[model samples]
Target: MTLTESVNLDNCDREPIHVPGHIQSHGALLAFDAALRLAACSDNAERMLGFALPALGADLDAPQFAAWPHVTQAIGDFAQRSHGTSGLAERSEVQVGGRVFDLILHFNGRLVVAEFEERQPADREIRPFTTLANGALGRLRLQRTIDDLLQVAVTEIRSLTGFDRVMAYRFRHDASGDIVAEDCRPDVEPFLHRRYPAGDIPAQARRLYVINTLRFIADVGAAPVPVHTAGAEPLDMSWATLRSVSPIHIEYLTNMGVAASMSVSIVIGGELWGMIACHHLTPMVVPYGKRMACDVLAQLLASNVQTLLAADHAKRIEAASSVRVQLMETFVGGDGLLAALRPHAAALCTTFAADALVASEGTETFVHGGVSAAAGAELLRWLRSSKPPEGLLAMSEQAKLPPVLSAALAPWCGILALQMDDNRHDWLVLLRPEQVETVAWGGRPEKVYKAGPHGMRLTPRGSFDVWRETVRGIAVPWSATELEIARGLQAELHRAGGARRAQVARDRDQMLAVLGHDLRNPLQTIAMASQLLARGADSATVGPRITRSSTHMARLVSDLLDLSRLQGGLGLAVEPKPADLARLVREAAQDVTLGHPGVEVAVEAPPQLQVPVDAARVRQLLDNLLGNARQHGEAGRPIVMRLEASATQVTLSVANHAPPIPPESRDRLFDAYKPASLNNSRNPGGMGLGLYIACEIARGHGGTLVYEYHEPFVVFVVTLPREARAAAAGEA
Candidate 1:
């Protein structure tokens, strides 16, 4: 197989660590068949358990195991628990041969497996777990910053675990890590502040760290005993605390001249944030009690770290908010929007720690600091046309940029741009200068290969040499706080612009009201003159034609006046009185029939349904609904008007068979001057004012007008309260 394929097979993610056919020398494992007869055993079982290897098929009740009754009983209990489970259970400490040993039992298919590890006696001076945990926590609470907190953690862990070195390692954004804090012996070489490549800890290894919080390896130089089994596949030991370490990792530690090691994971926000790695120069075993104490300490540290980071972020946001307020005040006091921002451009850039700033609106461009005029224009063009996501674009590296943009934006490698307005080509751009630095790596990061039994295989780097590399074409990264502040500024600008537009709309509506009132006098005069001229015999036809045109003009003018009043603060005017709504609907329907011949009008109403309403306004509401139905309803189809009265309210429904309204048009259907369709030919002679006026009249009487587009029909409903005065008072 190719070396790449070999590397992949041995990759921690794909490695068959569960069935590795191996076990640590510190433990002895044995397997038995369904009949409780010995099936297979690890090579060291005879030395550790005092069991003969040649007697593999011997029954469990044989004379040889009579001295170890506790071992047999423990195995029996484990078998019963593993029956319906995943064939695994927790380790139990038992006494055998006048010594304490940890026993682990599991079932692989039909074969029962048992592992045993002898435990060493604890020192008399070792402190109780509660005492140690309390002292560690007390020390941890004294820290005020992340650096201080991490330093305390490494020191406390080293003292508790008795390791030669304890380092607080933190992962960067790209998965690489650096030794941020260390507590080690004076004779050992320091790994503090040194960087390690992401590949040094593979993805699967990192995931395992999150699952199994603490891992301990007593001796890296010891041989791994083969786990013999009758079945072709080996047992899965992923949760085994005594599980054998990977071969590559052993070599890695050996090269560092480390005899043993242990690591505890530091989790934050439910993710693998970093680790507290400890190395020992000699073989050393940490008892389960001590390991538990370390785990508790790590968890406490994670909680404190989260709180400190949040507080730091809040401080940054407060500073940014102050800067934003100053810029906004400048805009409000200036002669124009662009003029307001130009003078404060340098301060705006500095808020985000950028070296240059550029603001562009239409043909006018303002540039400050290091950016050239040509580069600013080119960047503006890209910002407008590219349409980056969230109206914000950011890049930290220039080497990875597209060639066309790189050529024009040299030296200024990084950019953070925010579009100021959605309707215009205006933007605010922040430029950062290129930053160059050299990074020190532990060793050559590239894969190295060597000839092996399988042809070729990858091997860990043999040397721990320091390799330095110079990086260019990248700038210092922008923090999360800066991006959040940019978004906040965009939102404030939008709010201010909306307020300005609303004022302009109010001015336009007032002007229309005045113009509509002025045209009324001329139209009234035309109507009166036409009627007087109709009395003459010679001008009879011409006079009548002029009268019809003037009457239509007068109705149009009245509609304009009502619409203007409705849209303004003063709503519809109404005087309510007891009236028969049925009579009003019939009269309106008759008028529609007269206007359009051959169009059927059907009215379904009770004999007498009285409600408190304005007679003229109700008639107007009915007339507008009928007119809308006649204009849009399909030809030769009947229009239905139904009226129903209840204890509290009365409902009037007008429905017709016509083409369904477009989904997009339904929302603004009642808006003045907003036609159902943009095509004028669809509903010719429609001023689009009918529905708007109908809605206003309904509101005046404490009623509502609504439309629904059911298949094969378009329906409009107007509902009015039975007690109009009570409804109007409640609304007020």
Candidate 2:
């Protein structure tokens, strides 16, 4: 009956207004009248905006409503009925505040009725030149080393524009596509390692993923591409959703839902290589500029992928023919082919963060990188299971690997499986992605799988791994230039493997020799010290001597243990603070003097020369140098000790009257088990581990321990590189 009720009826489509009894009964009509007028349309509606839009009756007297400059002048006339222009209907789309609206004007009786309909911002920028340049240049850059090149391109773009998840969605022969490279959400599990089957994306939808170089579905629930076209001809199967797709797409998504999706195709050489997919958990309406920026990013990625892949193809030829020929001489029937190709692995394959050239012999495998035998076994199992009879098969599903293997190889995210033989000569060159987020696309819909009673079930658009292309055939024909490079690499790896084996043997021999000789001297020292004490000397004299001898003996044992710990990769536990060098020097001198009563040990250090050093290690260092000087150098010459402190380095030099070491020997004087006789000591007691251990200790604290072969006096200097005095002062 009232204006409010009339308006409500129109919206409700003949249904009665459902106002609550409690909110009605009194002054309802008055309150509802104001509410109905206010709610007739949006605040900007022409009917509600009288100040901005002149009343229909006042149009003749009112200043003519200034036609928007974007609209055509004259507007074709709204009041020439006799001239057949009165019934003219005019409608155009207008943009205001990044939103588009359909502006319609109609002549009714003697007045004009104007209405506006909201239109989505689905219109694209018409920059044919920009698009052409991007498409052309982008495709060229992408084909080089497609794997690493795409990853880098995606990473750089993602950084430039912050996107939650970005990926490289690669197309397959089947209509479906998979996200091969991805930078995923921080808390979510990585989706880099799995392949999505064709069923994952419907045939028609996938066609769009490839054809539509840049497609944005802002809000799936709101703006949908209508499939109905009255005059359209029969759709070809190749077209994406040309006819009509089921509502199941929305239901299927709602079941395993993605709220928003933005896909940018990676087209190389006019063929769709892949797409950059950006996803969102909640509904998002992307800004026009943002979408354009992503399109530009995709163009860059496409170019890089093409460039890099072409380079890879060339490299593969070089490896298979030329490199293979060279490898034949060294490896024969062995898996040494992969070992020969390692030096170029970094440059040739940039997607890999770390790599290993592993040789498979039967079930057993040998690794050339820093992998242990146990680790090698795990790696071999993975490669053998997936590798082809010949050539390479790249795998990106490292995260889904077994716990043991994945735990050990947590650093690498991908693997390149290459088979060299039917027997005991298969090789796996593993590749680790630099960061988990490098290859991600910006518009891949998030897939969430529901957890079942047994375990998690993978659902459509749910979290899973992805791999682009895993080629299983041999290198497709080789060129002259390619053969030469491959052969060179193969030869190089063969030589390298031999050199590696030789070095390992030499290291093993050195360790064994050091162990045998170093272990014996301490036992001998302890036995001699015990024998001397057992002889008939006064308990007062013998007891002190025995203690002093035992102290040095204990020091030998401790040094050996510490050296073992360092060599075994255990870090030193340091509790550093300010320490006085003079006090430590005096204490070390006193300890050295306890055993040798006849020798006069003197310390010439400044009283207040303070330095930051590990007190225990410094004391042991001074003790060993002084002891070596007394036992090997001229016993009569005073073991002069001087401590010098500069702004950055604290130097403790111990000089003794010993023959100058040979130039060659000086370089290796601090090496473990190197004969101490090089310092002109006839009786170089204790293992050569003393200086070696000392040097290790010094370096651990950002310092150096070097032996200077000064004429007549070989000086062992411990230089501790420290923060500047000004820095120390600042901290203080």
Candidate 3:
């Protein structure tokens, strides 16, 4: 509705008209009970009560409802009634199905006023002033995330007031109440989807609901007040006796079998909205002062709601709409998403605090942008080993993270991660490390941590201010609106991604195009040369040329396949079998020497040192290391291959006369595309995947291959288990 249209009452035919004078004098009243079922009462009683009330079918002479000493005395009083008919009434605090009423009496004559009120437990513990304030703020923090808001609010209320069942009650104009939300104490009956009738809470009683919005009712058994007439000039209702409660209302509760109930109206902007109801099967009393405090809490909550909603709704919607599109676009940019987030690495880390990472499950690839550069390798290893949860995470914390992360991210202080999955497409993650105090540095969210041991002494507003400041400094503040926008944006991006799958396919074509141009031409030239040699040109010349060309082609194919398997998630084929470790070492050394006749190669493999392995893959592994040394090391220096075996394992070490690997390249030795030489002369005609693939192949065979830095020489070691060696020994 337009704002102008809303305010223009003249055009609003259905809108209720309000008179300012009536609002001030007796408060505005909206009629609730217009429809009445047929019922009969005596003329005098009808005149007295001002209405033809329903039949309850009972005498007025009962001792509880009247002043009869016993049932017999009440019968005697009934017998002495006048000739005209008297009023009929029923009172009960027990099981009588249908609408129950309480503390009822009938005088067989017309009454002056028929007021309505419910009996309540007189003693309720008033929450301390400090608790109310602290709790209110705690609720605010809980509301930072969407899913947590309702849960946190319910938990806080249940804990503060100790209600058996504390529920967030919602009301419709028809005078009915439904439990919209509830937080039941442990072991209590779950009330999640429970519904209740509106007649349970009468319209007259609802009008007075807000007075105790923050009240505490301790016990209902001890209520003290002088019974007084309704509408008496000085009628005092602060107590039970001074104000007459409706007999029908009491009967209604009794029939329902609820002994004691406490309700605090949740008023937003001084207007009645709904309520928080605490119901117990047993009677209880709440002290007056405590009740007042509860009212204050209700007022505070109402004010917050009012503040949040009072702003121009359009302005808020517009602000949210503006950024949502871009946020979602950033979330689902596919391969480009990671690159797009690189600049916001710090922002992402601070937002999630931890549990932040950028990953491509499609490629089994992930980048830990939140971790330090020194810790990237470690973080990657962690990501490879750790599994992410399914679907988009609405909001989850690291506390529930699997135990494995602790060992993996041990280098960093604390760890946190949050992820959003794009349908089934990809994942967007935010990771954080403890020492990376984004909270204290950002000052975005105002947080209130639970008070320390000293209850009143350590509120967020008081003793914990210093710690609050620290956390506040590090946490990047994201408003609820911001999160909503981000969520909406992510959803949009997911939709866009579905629409752009064709574009993405085209992009993949572009990648293949680049790959063909950059890689296939050289391979094809070598293949042509090999084909010419095989055509029987010249044995001496073409024989070696054929071998060289074939080896080049083999290397190219091996690199391509290994890269494909790594990206494809197809486990490498590794056949571990009995083989002579000594013979394999000598053969690999001889192979490298044949390729480089200028370099001297020596093997020191013992005849008894046999290992179970795939001989050809092992030979390739050693040849790669030795060939790398010959192609990059000093020509005349001896390249030594050493072999040793333990009872359970065998080790092969190859050392060449080369300077120690540079410090910068040491960490990335096994990383694909990271050659030892940036100028591309380190291993002429070599692809950097040689070392990486060799490492993977060794791991596949349940062994490890690594390089160690030794001054004037770089040593590459391959370690294999004794089972492989024992099998080989037995075979030999």
List TM-score per model, in order.
Answer: 0.58, 0.35, 0.42
User: Top lDDT: which candidate number?
Assistant: 1
Error of 1 at 31 (Å): 11
Candidate 3: Cα lDDT at 373: 33
Residue 46 alpha-carbon offset, candidate 1, angstroms: 7.6
- lDDT (Cα, tens digit) per residue for candidate 3, span 225-339: 2221222232222212113233232323343344555667877544457677776657654333433445555565565555555453345556556444444445444234443
What TM-score number comes out for model 1?
0.58
| Candidate 1 per-residue C-alpha lDDT over 1-732 given as tens digits, one digit per residue, 9 for 90 to 100 | 122346533454565555567777877887776777777678888788765554777877788877777887777667766773543555677776676776767665566777777767763223575587779989999999888888999999888888999999888766778889999999987888877887777776776677667878888988888776656656555555566877667767877888988888888776788889999999987775577689889998988998888897798778778877877775543323455676677777877889998776544566778788778878888788888887888888997666778788888888888887765477888999888878777777665677533345666666767777887898987776788888888777666556544653654465445445445555666666666676664465566556655766676677777876754535567888999999998888888888678989999999888899999988988988887887788889999999999999999999999877776676556655452322346454345678878887886787789997777889999999998653234322
| Number of backbone collisions per candidate | 0, 54, 63
After superposition, which runs of candidate 3 have C-alpha atoms over 4 Å from their true positions?
1-259, 263-290, 297-390, 393-538, 675-679, 724-732
Candidate 1, residue 167: lDDT = 96
Tens digits of lDDT, candidate 2, 1-732: 122222221232222211111110000000001111111112233332232433322332234344443422222233332133333445455553455544544442233333343444453343443464454345436444567655755564455334556677676554346556787569655556345554555444544555545655444454322211112222121211111222334334444345666667788776666777666656665543445556676777666666666787676654455434544443432223332343444443332333444455333344545545556566767666654433455445554567777776655545555454434144545444324332233234344445522244333343233323433212222233333443444344445556644653565466556555655665565576578767865667556555655665676577668766754445344444578878999888887677677666767888876676777877777777887778767767777788888887888888888888777665456655454332233543355566777776665565667777678778889888565222112210
List RMSD in Å for every model shown.
Answer: 20.2, 24.1, 19.8
